[model samples]
Target chain A: MSQFLQFLFSGLTEGAVYAMVALGFTIIYNASDVVNFAQGEFVMLGGMVTFFANAAGIPLPLAALIAILVAVVAGLALNRFAIEPARGASVVNLIIITIGASIFIKGLAQLVFDKRFHRFPAFSGDDPIRVLDATILPQSLWVLFGACAIFSGLWLFFARTLVGKAITAVAANRLAAELVGISAKRMMALSFALSAAIGAIAGILITPISPTSVEVGTLLALKGFAGAMLGGMGNPLGAVAGGLIVGIVEKMSAGYVSTNYKDAVAFIIIILTLLVLPTGLFGKARVDRV
Target chain B: MLAREEASGPAWLSVEGLASHYGRIQALRDVALTIAKGEIVSLVGANGAGKTTLLRTISGVQPASAGRIVFEGEDITTLAATARVSRGIAQVPEGRQIFGPLSVADNLRMGAYLRKDGEIAVDMDRIYALFPILAGFRARPGGSLSGGQQQMLALGRALMSRPRLLLLDEPSMGLAPVIVDQIFAAIVRLKSEGMTIFLVEQNAFAALSIADRGYALETGSVILSGNARDLLADEKVKEAYLGI
Candidate 1:
């Protein structure tokens, strides 16, 4: 029973990261139809830049704040330089552009920071807290709390706020949003900023456990993309649910099956979900107008 | 562009020599139309008669291939759709393009997104009062609403913008007769409130009954235009558009 509890906690912590990344994917996908492959770079940037900033003697909170700011700006640049220029381009072209961006950021990270893995101290104390005979690290709690806070924030932003509704409007029908005076261009930029900020938060929270490296983004991006697909693209709630599902599945698979093939579990679930219910758990199938 | 400048002549909205196309197929050709302040003008036509194209071009969604669009005595032919919207032109597009995932209340708020006023809640209450059905379903996702209710939501959303000119496209499409009566009654109420409206409808007889004036558009050009009562009584209009 303790073993099961341990796996559940561990799964939730990892799932939080995927949930944040999936939320990031949802924002960009809603604002622009392009599925951004470079989304993982935001995570890398958050971890690496904060690591360097902390090394330079900055406080951890300040370093995290700076990392988030940098990620937002970088995300805006990605939208402006890469996404906007390729507007109306084929989906395959968008895929290439974002993938190319991911590679470019990875290369830039190697040039700017050392290739060695880096870690930051946990936000709170490093004491292990026991719940029902399951010991969990303090940092894991921080990650879980951060994920919950972000999800709540996004829910309020989309459901209650006017600007958020405009974003929702653009997501639903760009032409209609524009006809009602919502600037689709500005909304697009804001989506990228929001997406990157969410990714940065995920990175900052997980850096202690996961460590930071230039190449870390590739696998994280893939998993995050998978989670988003599993939840249904363009759905924020689905992103969170999908992230938790993937995380728990991977944890259970590693515990009961084979640790080496843990990653395969997420992919298998995604394939099955797509084959069975293509729109996903919380996603609605879009009705085609005749 | 030059034609747009001339169309800015002391009218709520004016268009001259307006042309639009979908690829090589021209949807609107040299279409000229105008609406006076506080007047309800209806553009009645059959499907494929370019009524929608004309409204879209005026709102800046479908750019004009040639000619000018002036709103409130200013040239807006070159502005983007959002910009035009901020200048007091709001459109309730055909098929009622409400955000399906959003709540009915949130959808209405999206209409007032550009407004800096703090009384959004007040405006929302006003919309609810106008369409009690929407108020009852304000918490429901827009997609959950029936077709007639969605049209009401769309029109209510457009009203949230406090637009000086409201352009409605085919508001009667796919609606039951009872709902159509409600929608038409709402238009009458709006007109009584001194709203300037440009209405496009395939239901020519119903539209003509509510309009102060009416224009007959065929293949993107106005073949006949006169007082609404006169157009309703015309033999050609009755045969071509009214299904008489």
Candidate 2:
């Protein structure tokens, strides 16, 4: 029973990270129809930069803050230099641009911060809290809480705030949204900023358990994209649900199944989900008007 | 002509040589038109005759290929759509583009998004009064509304902006006759309340019935311009658009 509880807690913690990454995918996809391949770089930036900053004597929270700001600026730059100039290009071209951006960012990270793996101290103390025969790290709770808080914050931003609704409108119909007086470009920029910030938060929170490296972003981006696809590309709630599901599945496969094939399990589930529910579980099938 | 009779009525908006394009296709070709304060100016045409394009250009959704757009004597040709909305220019786009997932009330509130005044609440009540069915279905998703109700919602949204110039594109398409009458009645009410309007419609008879002035467009140019009553009576317009 304790083993089962341990697995559940660990699964949830990993899910929280995936959820944040999935959210990043959701926001960028909502603002621009392009599925940004470079989204994982934001996560890497958060973890790697925060780790180095802490090692260089900066406080943990402040380091995380600076890392998040940097990620946001980088996201904006990605949109401006990489996405905007190539606007209305073919889907294949868009995919190549984002993949190029991911590679470029990874190369830059390697130059800026050495290829050596690094870890950061958790926000709070590193004590494990025991619950009903199961033990869970305090950092796990931090990650879980952070994911929930970010989701709630995003919910309020979209439902209650004007700017958020403008983003929603743009996602729904760009031409109509423009006719109704919303700037599609500004909303696109805002999406990138929001997406990168969320990714950075995930990286900062999880770096204590899983150390950061330049190449770490590629896998996270793939997993997050898979999670977002599982949840439905544009559905925010679906992204969170998808992330948690992917995390739990991966952990179970690693525990009960072979640890080496854990990543393979995620991809298999993605393929199955795509085959069965093409629009995703939460996404409605959108029909084109003639 | 009604426009001549209403000449002393203040000039509320003007479009001078307004041109627009869709990719390589020039959809609007050097169009010039005007709407006086408290007047309804209708642009009538067939599908692809640039009726929708003209409304889109005025609202700044489609960029002007060349020439200028003036609203209340201000050159607004280069302004972004949102900027124009804040400047009191609003449009009800073709096909009644209501936010499908949003609640009816929220969709209406979105129309007044740029309004900083405290009277937004009052405007909500006014919109509700104008479309009682919408008030009743305020909590329902906008997509649940029928085609005509959606049109009403779109018009209500534009009115929420309290716009000096309201541009409507094809409000009567795909609606039942009774609903079309209801929409036309709402337009008449708006006109009676002194709102300047630029209406685009393929339903020339219905559009000309309420319009003070009319411009008949073909391909991308205005082929005829006159009082709505005269255009409704013209031989060419009768054979082509009015179905007489």
Candidate 3:
């Protein structure tokens, strides 16, 4: 029983990070219909830049803030320079652009931050907390809480605020949104910035638990994309649920089945979900009248 | 009916020799029209006759390759669609493109996104009063509404922007005659309240009946223009558009 509980705790902590990444995917995808493969790089940037800033004697909170700010600027630059120039391109072409962007960012990070893995101290101390005979890291709780806070913040923003609804209106119908005075271009840039900030928070929360290298973004992005596909592509709530499911399933499979194939589980579930339920668990099938 | 005195002033909106193309295919060719403040002008045409294309150009969604569009005596031909909207030109696009996943209330709120005043709530109440059915479905997703109700929501949404010129593209399409009557009645009420409307429609009889001045468009050009009542009685318009 304690073993099961331990696996569950670890699964949940990991799932929280994936959930944040999935959310980033969903926001950009909704705003521009582009699945930004560079999402994971924001995570790496958060951890890496914070690590360097902390090494330079800045406080942890301030370092994290700088990281977030840097990530937002990078996101804006990506939208303005890369995405905007290639507007109205085919979906496949857009996907390739993001993929190319991911590779370019990864290469740039390796050059800027070196190839070594690095981690910083946890936000709350490295002590372990026990729950029902199972021990969990304090940082894990921080990850879980951070994820919950972000989800709630996004919900409030989309549900209660006018600007947030304008973003959603653009996602729903770009032409109609423009006709009603919502600037789709501005909304796209905002989505990128917001998504990047969310991703940076995820990175800051998880780096203490899992040391991050410059190349870590590739694996994280693949897992996050799988999570997004598992949840419906554009649904924020579904992305969270999908990410949690992926994380839990991965941990459970590693514990019960085979640790060697733990990574394989996410891909398998993604494939099966796509084959059987293409619209995803929470996605509504789109219907258009001619 | 209100007097047509508003039509005698300088044009509130003017399109001079406007031309648009879909790549190599020209959708509008040197099309010209004008609307004065507080005048309900109708552009009646058959499908593929460039009515929608012209309206879209005026709204700045479709770019004009040539000529100029002037709104309120200022040349606004180079403005973006959202800028045009901010300048008091709101379009209830064809097919009622309400945000399907959003609540009807949120759809209405989206229309007032650019407004910076405190009277948005009052305007919202007015919209609710205008389309009471929408008020009842305020919490429901816009996609769930029936066709006629969606049409009302679309019109109410446009009105939420407090636009000076309302551009409606086929407000009566795909609706039952009774619902069409209800929508037209609401439009008549708006005009009586001093709203300027640029209506585009294939339903010539319904459009011309309410319009003070009407233009007949055919194959990307304005072929005829006259008083709506006179056009309604024209033999050529009756044969080609009204099918009477």
Model 3 TM:
0.96
- Relative to the true interface, what fraction of contacts does candidate 3 keep? 0.67
Each prediction's interface RMSD?
A: 2.6, 2.9, 2.2
User: Candidate 1 has which clashing residue pairs, if any?
Assistant: B4-B68
lDDT of 2 by residue, A1-290 (tens): 88778878898898889889999999888778888889889999999988888788998888899999999999999999999999999878998999999999999999999998898777677888989999989999899999999999999999888888878877776776776677889899999999999999999999898888999899888888878889888899999999998888888888888899988866886898889988787988653232
Per-residue lDDT of A266 in model 3 = 75
Docking class of 1: medium
> What are the runs in model 1 whose C-alpha is more than 4 Å off?
A89-93, A284-290, B1-11
Per DockQ, the best of the predicted structures is 3
Candidate 2 Cα errors over 4 Å, as ranges:
A286-290, B1-11
Best prediction by lDDT:
3
Cα deviation in Å at residue B92, candidate 1?
Answer: 1.4
Q: In model 1, state the lDDT of residue A39.
A: 88
Off-target runs (Cα >4 Å) in candidate 3 are A286-290, B1-11
lDDT of 1 by residue, A1-290 (tens): 99889989999998899899989988999878888888889999999999999999999999999999999998999999999988899989998999999999999889989799999998887889989879999999999999999999999998777788888888888888888888888999999999999999999999998798988888778778778888888888999999988888889889878899988877887788889978888888664231
Q: Which ten residues in a row have the lowest lDDT in candidate 1 chain A?
A: A281-290
Alpha-carbon TM-score of each model against the true structure: 0.91, 0.95, 0.96
lDDT string, candidate 1, B1-244, tens digits: 0001223334488888889999999998888888997789999888899999999998888889999988776899999887887787889999999888788988898888888878778878988888898988988889788999999999989988888788999999999999999999988888777678899999989999999999999898888999999999999998998878
Q: What is the TM-score of chain A alone in each candidate?
A: 0.96, 0.96, 0.97
- The local lDDT score (0 to 100) that residue B169 gets in candidate 2 is 89
